[model samples]
Target: MAAVNVALAGRSYEVLVGSGLLGRVHCEAYSFLEPYGQRSIPVVADANAKRLLGEHLQASFRSAGLSIDWYEVPSGEASKSWAELEKLTDWLLDRGITRSDHVFALGGGVVGDLVGFACSILKRGCGFVQLPTTLLAQVDSSVGGKTAINASAGKNLIGAFHQPALVLADTACLASLPIREMRAGLAEVFKYGLLGDAEFFARVDADSNAILSHDNTVLESVITHCVGMKARIVAEDERETKDARALLNLGHTFGHALEAETGFSDTLLHGEAVALGMVLAARFSARRGLIAQSDAERVADALARAGLPTEIAALGLDCDGAALADHMRNDKKAEATTVPFILLRAIGEAYVARDVELADVGTFLDEQLRAH
Candidate 1:
């Protein structure tokens, strides 16, 4: 087991990465739930995950004298909605939940985001724990406190920085994930290296196969390193007042555009969009002379090699580059009149570029659409 701490002034919490944690939750993660003193623990899970893992989790909790007050949402992007949020908050209130009780968010990012947001606004504020069951959530979203639901304008537009009280990333849950989900998670894992660490990127480039095959040692080590990197960056810039935390959005700006183009459905998973977005960012940087075209293709190769989509043409997007660029205007990182992009200087060094014009971005994306 490896523990990485997200050390904030008074909000510090540990992100525990290990095997079979959910089975031992009432004992191993008992500290986070102990505050409510044997009260039935509230758990909100992704519906499919409930179908797959609920019985086992329930058996473990029963053995430890804990009862689960359960609520489940459908398993997809649509679950992060105003209707779902309202339903979940009402359920918590109906359960007579108090500010002292911590809600456990199981399954993937959708569950975590919804539960975290619900906890953040519940009776002004309540505590929640992140039981991230997906590789994407474990390595990125579960620790950052950037919880949100997708808005009509854009993805993650309605959200807050309400950090979780604790995070237990059970690596074992990954055994049940579909191959596509596992590959999608690799996209986020690749981001940490793409933004800053060449050595780590190289490691991923070499170990992608091992990680994909469910090599526990490699998965745990990779998860720990990615979580540790995210923890440090988030701690340095909790609310993104500075640009440090923004660096984490390297592929997100373009990725959001791709998501909007697809209507934010499972037609394109979040991490797949991010994977393509990072490739676009790299190629865009090369187009403007920020990096060599060779390095840009290498970025695409790395992600593609790992089974992530690296080409925009494969998406068969009907809209033009201008349309995609317009979608970016709704991005949260956009300033009064500018949409800042996280561009690459090299394979592992990314920077925020605010001077690029929206029209130029359209033209560049046009070129990408035409290339291959």
Candidate 2:
């Protein structure tokens, strides 16, 4: 087992990562839950993951003399809506969950975001644990303490900064994940490299196949590396008030817009949207002379090598630049007439640019869409 801590001052927590970690979660999460007394563990997982890993968690908790109630919701980004939030909260209330009880988020990013947010607002605040089962969640979302629900206005419009008491990322879950999902998860892992470490990007580029094939050693190393990066940044700026947390959102500005335009459909996975978004950022950075064209090409080439989408035109998205830019204007990062973008100066370095003009963004989007 490997562990990293998110040092959020008073709300610090540990992130445990390893293969078969799910089966051993009770022992791992017990210390966090101890602070809340004998409060029942409300396990929240997506339908698919509930069958795959939730049972083990439930049984483990039961065996440890801990009370647990399993709750399963349909999977996907759509599950982050208000309706689902209300439904899940109602279920929790019906089960008699109190402020002292801890909700265990036992799935991917969507499940973790929704459940964590639900716990945050329940009776003002309740404890929660994140058992991120997806590669994307394990390395990014689940570690950040930024729990949110999607509003009609945009993605993650309604949420809170309620950090989890613990985060358990089990590598065993990846063994059964579909290949496309695995590739999508790698997009976020790639984002870590693109946003911060050039050498990490090089490492991933070299071991892309090994990481995708669920090679145990490679998976552990990559997850640990990515989580360590996230933990350091999150510990420094938990609320994104400073620029520290924004670096983690390297491709999210464009990615969130793509998700909204697609209505958060399966047509474009978050990772797929992010893959294209990072390419867009790189291409635009190169166009603006912030980075060289060769750097942009290398970014695209790396994504393609990982089997991730690198071209917006190829996605068959119905919207053009104007439409996409409309979506961008509504992004949470938007301020007045500009959106904070993490533009790359090179393969491994990313910076937040708050002076981006929409006209330029529209022009770039138009060019990319035209190629499709």
Candidate 3:
């Protein structure tokens, strides 16, 4: 087992990455639930995840002589809507959850985001734990404390920074994941390397095949490292008031736009959009003389090697660059007239560029959309 701690002055938490973590949650997170002894544990899982991995979690609770107060989150990004949020809160209220109680969020990013947000606003900030079942969630979304539901305006525009008390990233759950989803999760894993660590990027670039094959050693190492990096950044900038946390959005600014264009559906997964988004960000940086063209292509080549979509033209979207750029006008990162981009100076070195003009973005994206 490997553990990384997110150090907040008064709100610190631990993220554990390893195999069999789902079976260990009852022991690992016991302290949080100890205060409310003998009460049935409140756990909300993604419907699909419940079907697949519910038995493991149920056994964990069963061994502790506890019963699960279960709720099922509808599958997909749609669950992060106003209607679903209302439904979740109503259910929690009826379950008699208190601000002092803890709720367990199971499954991938969608479940984590929805339940984390629901807990944040439930009785004005209750506690929650993240049992992230997907590679993307286990490494990124589950650790940052950035919880949200999607809005008409944009993805994650409606949410809060309510950190989870504990995060158990069970590597075992991933063994049965479809290869497509596993590949999508690798996008976020690769983003960590792109954002800060040059050597780590090279390592993953070389070992992506092994990582995708569910190599247990490689999987746990990558997850632990990503979680460690995230822990350090989140500890430094808890609310994103500083640039440390913002740097973590290396691919998300452009990724979110692609997602918005796709209606945030299965047409493009979040990590897939991020994979393409990082490619665009890299190429755009090279265009602006921030990085070399070869470096940009290297980034694209690395992601493509892992079977991710690395080009915008391949998406075959009906919208042009201007339409995609228009989607950015309401991005969560948008200021008066600019949407700050996380641009690369080189591989493994990303920085914020706030001078980006949306019109220029439209022109650049138009070039990408037309390129092979």
- Give RMSD to native, each candidate: 1.0, 1.6, 0.9
Better of 1 and 2 by TM-score: 1
After TM-score superposition, what is the CA distance of residue 43 in candidate 1 from its true location, in Å?
0.5
Give residue 33's error in model 1 in angstroms.
Answer: 2.7
- Residue 365 error, candidate 3, Å: 0.8
Worst 10 residues of 1 by lDDT: 29-38
What are the models' TM-scores?
0.98, 0.96, 0.98
User: For residues 1-372, could you state the per-residue lDDT of candidate 3 as single tens digits?
Assistant: 898999999999899899998997789998876776778888899998999999889998889888888899888888889999999999999988999899999989999999999999998999999999899998899998999999888899999999999999999999867888899999999999999999999999998999899998999999999999999999899999988889988888888999999999999999999999999999999999999999999999999999999999998989889899898988877898799899999899999999999999999999999999
| Better by lDDT, candidate 3 or 1 | 3
Residue pairs clashing in model 3 are none
Candidate numbers, best TM-score first, in rank order: 3, 1, 2
Candidate 3 to truth, TM: 0.98
lDDT of 2 by residue, 1-372 (tens): 789988877887888889888777667877755654576767888988988776677777777777666788899999999999999999988978888777888889999999988998888998888888888888888987888988888898888988888888889888878889899999998898999899999899899999899998999999999999999998888889999989888888888888898889898999898998899999999999999999999999999999999888877778779788878777777888788888988888898898898878988898998774
- Candidate 1 residue-wise lDDT, 1-372, digit = tens: 899999999989999999988888887668766666667888999998898889878988899777888898999999999999999999999988898788999899999999999999999999999888889999998988998998899899999999998898889989889989999999999999999998899899899998888888999999999999999999899999888889999889999999999999998999999999999999899999999999999999999899999999889999999999999889887876578889998888988898988889999999888889
Better of 1 and 2 by lDDT: 1
Judged by whole-model lDDT over C-alpha atoms, candidate 2 comes out at: 0.86
Of the candidates numbered 2 and 3, which has the greater lDDT value? 3
User: How many steric clashes does model 3 contain?
Assistant: 0
